[model samples]
Target: MDAGPFFHGTKADLKVGDLLIPGFRSNYRPEVVMNHIYFTAVLDGAGLAAEIIPGDGPPRVYEVEPTGEWENDPNVTDKKFPGNPTRSYRSAAPLRIVAERDDWTRLTPEALAEWRTRLARMRDENAEIIN
Candidate 1:
């Protein structure tokens, strides 16, 4: 799934923010592998909405199109992505890039720093591999 909004189960009506971190994979592999990490958006409905990057600067806002289609096979509930079947409805369009975050990156500084530090450490630890 691309960045922006996406639901966990089959609920599309509930919009949830997401952090699309590039160069990190979910599965076990070389630490230097360049993949993407997906982070769920968390924040209160009141006041200005921030991406909630811990120890970051002030919260920033971004324009979301509310475009996504999440789905799941009724028979499959325990399985996750890669081969899972499910569906989600949205009021916008699908994400063209799984690593779309220029808008989000410009907003939450702390979140961005956290991601950067982690990536640097990974690179430092896995100097033998190229991401």
Candidate 2:
């Protein structure tokens, strides 16, 4: 594995030692069930994900550990970039929440709004999830 210091981003309130499992709907595409629980080695990347999640709760980024094997996220890996420069991975296993990270940089309101707009456009276009 990447010997991570991994992190998962979400708007869900959680406690230390909680497990994040796969099979949940994609926060980016709610109609598509995610086959893997995604995490990143980059702190800000996770923070970006958390911020864009649709919810009324505050976005949260958590330090995490994977319980099983993981692979590069095909969605953003070669598909969107040349490599796993995003440091993103997905596992068909549970990710144990280690602790909450409060020091991640937050996006500006304008940046957040822009992201929401881009996501909404993807949804309206009926973007395809790689599964």
* Model 2 ranges with Cα > 4 A deviation: none
Give all TM-scores, in the order shown: 0.22, 0.96
lDDT of 2: 0.92
Residue 130 in model 1: lDDT: 18
lDDT against the true structure, per candidate, is 0.32, 0.92
Tell me how candidate 1 scores on lDDT: 0.32
Model 2 clashing residue pairs (backbone): none
| Per-residue lDDT of candidate 1, residues 1-131 (tens digit) | 43535321111122235432344332223433433222233212101123323334544333233334433322223443444323322221332222222243332567557755765675567533212
